[model samples]
Target: MNIAQSYEKPRWSADLCSCGDTGTCCITCLLPCITFGQIAEVVDEGGSSCVLHGCIYGALMVIQCHCLYSCLYRGKLRAKYRLPSEPCNDYCIHCCCEPCALCQEHAELKNRGLDPSKGWIGPPNAPPPMPPSMIK
Candidate 1:
């Protein structure tokens, strides 16, 4: 459980290696850019979009340093959630287990009632979404 680090902070609901959901694991394994972007969008409070971030991540693959970029989001996610660095630092986790790490973050967001699939609607306490007809 505590592979590394020392601090009293909120722990992840699930272990990083668990993948939490099979579908998430599959996506992360085959297309980690998608996973990373989804996480990044949520962490960015949806200031940017999943597609935009995903494209950037995919482009980073050519240089093979996408993991570092993704790691920064992991830090942001941790700060937002007040989660501690455990089972190793984010750098090591993303570098060594990028797929699993991405899957875990996606699962974590879902568990916390923040659906990455829906993108960012607003703050957690924002009013319910308006009907599509009202959006004109």
Candidate 2:
């Protein structure tokens, strides 16, 4: 499948997403899920523009930018709930595996054309990608 064309919502405008939307990141061995609701909450709470999904997008951009072996690190859920000034190095911003349960549930709900503005039940994943040069 064309990773770029698979999801309805891409990462270009992920920062502006509202709620119930889904996005992918390259931080783990599986696809990590992200939702607009989570984005909004992080933004509203004065958190950094970077979230788990954002980090995935970041890593992909790094690969596109550097054209080398740059790994995607897993983000820290515990630090996310903390103040924006706190250390979020857990998100790795380089390589990661930790997934968020609430975020994934929200994305699934949105995919089904349902609203999950309240909470989430599923977990997020972070799947690795084949290098662009390896693809025919």
What would the per-residue lDDT of candidate 2 be over residues 1-136, giving only the tens digit for each residue? 7976875442211121233233333222243323333433332332433254446554654555311112211123223323131123423322232333234323433453333343332333424567899999
Among all candidates shown, the one with the greatest TM-score: 1
Candidate 2 residue runs with Cα over 4 Å from true position? 1-33, 40-94, 98-136
Task: Report the number of clashing residue pairs per model.
Answer: 0, 18
Each prediction's Cα RMSD? 5.4, 17.3
* Best-fitting candidate, scored by lDDT: 1
Q: Rate the local accuracy (lDDT) of all candidates.
A: 0.86, 0.34
Assess candidate 2 and give its lDDT.
0.34
1-136: candidate 1 lDDT, tens digit per residue: 4645555557888788796788878888998888888888888987999999899899998999898899999999999999989788999998998888898889888888787767876666678888999998
| Cα error of candidate 2 at position 85, Å | 14
- How does each model score on TM-score? 0.85, 0.22
